[model samples]
Target: MYTDQLKRKLIIKKPIQRIVSLVPSQTELLIDLGLEEKVVGITKFCIHPYYLKQNKKIVGGTKNIKINVIKKLNPDIILCNKEENTEEIVAECEKIAPVHVSDIYTLDDCLELIHQYGNLFNCRTEADKITQKINFKLNDFKTFIHNMPKKKVAYFIWRNPWMVAGNNNFINHLLTLNNFDNIYNSKSRYPEIELKKIRLEGDPDFVLLSSEPYPFKEEHAFEIGRFTHHAKTIFVDGEMFSWYGSRLLKAFDYFKKLHNRII
Candidate 1:
């Protein structure tokens, strides 16, 4: 018997052979941990490897999942995340197999998740290697950004409702590590903001438009720049700011380049 990050008790059998990964980042981590063969099912958004969807069964999406398909997969364990998946989905998956839910809000939390995966899947060696690389890159980034001045910014995640990354989330955690002060740090999680409010209260130095969830193009940047006339609007890779897994190995370098470009 074992407990997940959410403190849910699970009876997981060793030598776990089958897996159903509902989160994209976790799916990628599983691959990095050399559990690719064990991953029987993955969501449509798990596109990191670019070839996973072609081989693995597609399980609807992060918000919506095909329960029937998961039931048929007959996975030994179902992997999920606190933010990427909902409580209802976790409850449903529990009926099919032991569910391991990870709740990550910081870099430390992400490292811990990797360690947990190591113990769970008997891949401690692979997990350690990944974490070591992340730490190496992370420390280098820290040294590179140590002297850089902190910049205030508003990170927009959506447009139709005008949502932005707020406090107490992985995005915000990474933003802080990059020395970017989120204008909405006072608010919890992702929050919707009015353009008027952005212009009035959040006088940010930059308006970062994410390249996922909404695909903010150059025209969108220009449109947002018009509203936040004082701030520079730039399209940033959502994966770098949000994806908290093996991708972080590349994300630190991306952040360094982004800072240099913006500077």
Candidate 2:
């Protein structure tokens, strides 16, 4: 039996077999760890591995999960993320089954989460291989971009509200690792900034628009280009920069490609 801070008692008489994933990244991680048969329920956003879309049952979004549907599925375990999911959803799911909440903001957090998941799923060997692969790839990217000039960059996640990734975020960490300076390093986490202020002082060398939380297109680039004439604007994969689970295995190759385009 396992008890969390909320005093949610988890009676794990046996290893978790029927698992439901509220978070997309963790769903992908389960697949990567060869637990595809165990993952019975997953969010619609868990689109990676392609086969999951055709095979797994859809539970709902991280924020708006169908509790009734989840109850019906009778999952032995549920996987979630702290930032991507809401506290209410986690609490609700805890009442039904053992819910493992992953709180990741840095590379270390990601590695720890991977190891934790490995322990929970009895896939320690696979987890080690995945971790080694991610480390090797990230190091390769770091080496490839080590000599490049560190240009200041602003990574946008939303529009209308206009949010930018700041220090302590996974994206910001990746940017720093890739030798890019995040202009909003003073600010902690993601912050909403007015376009007027961005024009006046937030003059970053590069503007990267993400494809999740808000889908930024070529038109947005042209729109932002009007204000920051000197900055190079490009669309970035939000999953590569934000997804902290098994998706990271493929992110290094993506980052390398992006770096090549920039240099």
Q: Which stretches of candidate 2 lie over 4 Å from their true place?
A: 1-11
> Candidate 1: TM-score?
0.97
TM-score of each: 0.97, 0.93
**Candidate 2 structure quality by residue, lDDT tens digits, 98-188:** 8888777778788887887777789999999999998988788778887889888889999888899888778888888878888888888
* lDDT (Cα) of model 1: 0.91
Candidate whose lDDT is highest: 1
Structure candidate 2, residue pairs in collision: none
Runs with alpha carbons beyond 4 Å of true place in candidate 1: none
